[model samples]
Structure formats: C-alpha cells, structure tokens
Target: MGGFGPLETAGPVLVWTVVLTFVFLECALIIGLFLPGDSMLITAGVVLASQVSGEVHVWALSVGTMIAAIAGNQVGYVIGQRTGHHLVARKNGKYINTRNLTRVAELLHRHGFMAVLVARWIPWVRTLCPAVAGAAGMDHRKYTIASSIGAIIWAPVLLLIGYYAGSFLENVSWLMPAVIGTLIVGLVLGTIVGVRQYRAEMARPAEDFDLDEAEQEPVADSPWRRA
Candidate 1:
C-alpha cells in the first residue's frame, strides 16, 4: 500500500521516470546524495528482471539514469560558474557554505578533472565538485567530457550492483526486507554523523569573515534574533 501507485507502476516509462528523477536529484544536490537511490535502483531491477517475458528492457532504466546524472552534473557546473561564491554569502546557507567551497576550490586547483571524477562517489563532495569545476574556470569542454565519463560510469555501476544483488537475492524474499531495513539504518547513521560533523565544522570560527554584529543586528523577538 505504501509502494508506487499506478502511474509509477507502468512498464518502461514509469521505470524510466523513476531512474531519471533519482539520478538527477542525486547528482544535483547534497540532500539527494544521501537518498536511497542505490537501493531503489536495485529494487527496480529485481522487480523488472522477472517481468522480462516480453516488452520491458531492464537496461533502459540504467541508461536513463546515466543520462539524467550527466545532465544534472552539467547543470550543477553551470550553476557553480554563476553562483558558487554567492551561495556562501547567503544567510543560513548550510549546504554550500564557505568551508565546503574552500575545500572544493583547493581540490579543483590541485587535481582538476580527476577531482570531479573521484568525487562522483563521495556524497558531500559529489554535488559540490561540478560547481567547483566552474568556479575554477576549467575549460567547459574538458569539464563536460570528464563529467560525462564520470556520470556514465558512476550511474551504471550503482544500478548494476543493485541489479546483481537483486538477481542473487531472488529466491530469498525474506532478505528483501532485511536489505531495505539495513539500508535505512545505514542512512540514519550516515545522516547523524554527517550532521554532527557539519555542526562541528560550522562551529569553528569563520576565518574569512569579521561580520559586524552592530550593523546587522536584528530587532527583539525577530526570527533572526531568536536564531
């Protein structure tokens, strides 16, 4: 009852939609990086695998995910070129804060394309790398090429892992719940650790800013003051 309803239960079209959305969001932002995208892909593959009696093409979902991921990275790169620096300046901007941007900038300066490629798997860094690429003024052509290769490899590999796992776990229906449960647990743990680390990082002095508290002080009872 809590599963995908009719619109998303259709054949290739529905599966394609799911794959595309998952990849796009996963590559587009840090929040998506922690989503159960990997698990969902595997579940889709396993479910679709047995239904391959005729019209469905399992690889279609995999290919669709790759396309979405690559496109997302490109979008992120363009956004970074335009706003990576500004994001750090925005109030309450926790995701793309100054420290993260500085770290990404250093990586881009040092490693260039290799940095983007390697960051494809690291959840926090994945979303930031493409934007950092643009901020570093890397050649658009090179960025596109490197990002395309990385996305193609990263997206398919994750889906394939899920596909293979689904195949192996086919006869054991009981294991499905266990796998999903374990993934949820892992996600919770990762989130807790990530949040703690982020808080700790943010708690450190903003070395670059000596913001004047008097000029920007909020009124009494204001939300900003409360914060």
Candidate 2:
C-alpha cells in the first residue's frame, strides 16, 4: 500500500503534515494507535529520500513525529486519569479489561521505570500504560515524565528504521505487499494471544477471596500467664 498511488502525494510538507497528525491522533485516541503509525513514519522518510529534489527533511519528520507522540501520550494520560478507571469499572464499558489492568499494575509496581520503558515499544499496551499508571494510583508527575520521554524516543526511532527500510525498498516491486501481509498476520496473532490470556485470567478466583471468606478461629493465648 506504500506504493505509487496514495503515497504519491502533492509534496513533502503536505505529506509530513499528515504523518504528524496521524501520529498525534494515534497516541491520544485509544483506537488511533492501530492506524499505520510505524509504516507512515518510515514511508515518509523513504519517500522523502527518493525524491529527486529531496524537499522533505528527515529532521522535520523526526521532530514532528516526536511532538505528536509526546503530546498524544500526555492526552491519553489525562483522559485515563479523569475517567478511565470509572469507565472500565462500568457495566458496559468495552475498552477496559480488569484483568490486564491488574496484571499491568503489578508489573508497574515490580518493574517501575523498566515497565514504562519496555511498554513504550509494545503497541496496544503503550496507549494503555499511562492510563493504567494513573488508575493504579501512581504519582501523576512521575507518570507524566516517564511517558513524555518514552513517547519521544520510541516513535522517532521506529520511524527512522522504517524510513531506511522504505528507502532500501523504494525501487523493489515485491516488498510492499509482503510487508503489509506480515503486519496483518502479526496483528491477528497478537489479538488471538491477548484474548486467550484475558479469558484465562478472568477465569481465576479473586486473589483475596479466601482471606476475605475464611472463618476467624479463637486466638491461642501467649503462655506468659497473663489473664
């Protein structure tokens, strides 16, 4: 899909504009990340490189993408803080998963910065991490700092890699279809795995069920012979 038709836009500036917009939207909106963020960044870079006049600048693309990414994550963090937990706990909410939230909360507690850093690289998890951090009662300032750094670093790096790859394959006739197909397959497999894990976790009893339900036995007195 990164071939001669739609990608062949009017000019470099216009192309980068669209790319930045998509990046921001994806980072902010829960459903937006699923859009072609990785592909667009790389494609934009590759397309710019191949232009005879080279009107599109790599630094511009990188900076614009980084801005969109950081801002998007910030918006997501605020939204999640404001209403995400209540929404998920609601009866009919579709976006929130209680099990995954709990697990990620535990991960955040255990791994802290590493969890946030690593989560930056993952797809769906990335969008949810900030919200999860907020909902899990983490300090807002810390979440903001970590998410801002993560978004800036993660988005540009991937875009650059894609840009180089796209440049390499600019002339190749067969590579585009193959990349799209692989992405689709990987997405499907990821969905299946996520669903299975969610289902399995939901089937387990609440961790505190036994503690909450167990009968209280009389305490044995210490043998100090006090009444």
Candidate 3:
C-alpha cells in the first residue's frame, strides 16, 4: 500500500498550518466569502484518520481549529463594530450603502443572538455574521457566547465527518477517488445554494426591514449592543 502520498509528504506541520490559516481567515476576513474552510477541515480530518502523515491527533486538531475560529470571529466583530459606526456616520459611500447597512441591522436585531449561532453553519454567513452582529450593536457578551457555541459545534462536527469518512475508506483504498469526487460534488452544490441565498437576501428591499430605537439600544450589562 502506497498510502496517501501527497498527504504523507505534506507532514503534520503543513497540514496544521493550512487548516489553521484557512479557518482563521474564513471567519475573520471578507476573503472567507470564497474560501472553503469547511472542506479544508474535512480534508484534515480525513488525513488524520487515514494516518497518512504520521500520528495526527484528532482532538488536537479540533481544539486548534476551534480556537482559531472563535478568535477569528472576535476579530471580525471588532472590525465591524468600529467600521460600521463610521459608515453609518458618513451616510454614503461607494462600499458602505446606508440602505444595506440598515437592512443588516434590522436582520441582526430581529434574529438577535440566534443569528450568531445559526450563521456558523452557513458558508458566507459564517464569515459575515460576526461583523453584522457588531454592526447591529448586538451585545458583545451575547455575540461572544453565541459565536463560541457555534464554533464549538461547527468545528468538531465537520472534522468528525471527515475523520469518519477517512477511517471507513482506509482499508478500501480504491474507493478514495469516489469519496473525494462525491465530496467535491457536494461542495459545488453547497456553494451554489449559498450564493443564491446571499443574492436573494441582498436583493430584498431595505424598506422591508424596520426597527425601533429601543430595540437598537446597547445593553450596559452585556456587550450585546453598542451601536
């Protein structure tokens, strides 16, 4: 058995680096809108389970990914909090359309903390929701709690799926290609769905969303609202 030659040669260091970097960036930056962090996580899980690159502990990988995801969300939240205020104050700009911002605020307000948790499972939303929460003045403490919960659930679940798949295929080496092909198909379909959803959301009229001043008020006891 030759094993997974590419993964074997890449080694643990490279695997860890790639997974952590993609995970962090996918949560923290706008670039994450296009990055397939979930796929990477699943791939990492497969690599570890297959034992192609020495003994890579599943727990260690999960923990590292969880930390990176949580921290990345924090960074994105801060960026949104700071930039959102300025965008609102300015009223108009090429990138900061007040109408869109208002809609985002309304969405965040209506969903509250639940959005943070749900968004984690979503692709583009996972990267954008933290910033949206911050922009909407969601209590920071609540955001943190929700994001933490989401990250905890999201990271391990995807990793485990990949790990299990790899483990099952370890002995059936010939099936590796089929399994990978299936994953690719799934990813493509998922991306198409996510993009369509995003576009639909963006196309909705801003007037459809409305919020009262009281609802927008920042909570003093929690970092839930600051806008």
Among the numbered candidates, top lDDT falls to 3
Off by over 4 Å in 1: 1-13, 29-34, 53-56, 89-95, 173-227
Model 2: ten consecutive residues of lowest lDDT: 207-216
Per-residue error (Å), model 3, residue 85: 2.9
Query: lDDT, candidate 1, residue 189?
Result: 71
Q: Write down the TM-score of every candidate.
A: 0.66, 0.64, 0.72
**After best superposition, candidate 1 residue 64: deviation in angstroms?**
1.0
Residue pairs clashing, model 1: none
Candidate 1 vs 2: which has more TM-score: 1
Q: Candidate 1 residues 135-178, lDDT tens each?
A: 44556777787788888888777766765665566557667446
lDDT of 2 by residue, 5-74 (tens): 3334555666677678877876776555345556556556665654444434666677778788888877
Candidate 3 pairs with clashing backbones: 138-224, 139-223, 139-224, 139-225, 140-223, 140-224
RMSD of 3: 6.0
Clashes of 1: 0
Question: Candidate 1's C-alpha lDDT?
Answer: 0.59
lDDT, candidate 3, 1-227, per-residue tens:
22455555665676688778878988997656656678868977776765643235677888888899999999988987776543331123222244544555555666767767877887767876777676556678888998999999998888888888778887787886566556656655765765565455445443222223324544334335434
**Of the candidates shown, which would achieve the greatest TM-score relative to the real structure?**
3
What TM value does model 2 have? 0.64
Off by over 4 Å in 2: 1-9, 53-56, 89-95, 170-227
* lDDT to native, each model: 0.59, 0.58, 0.68
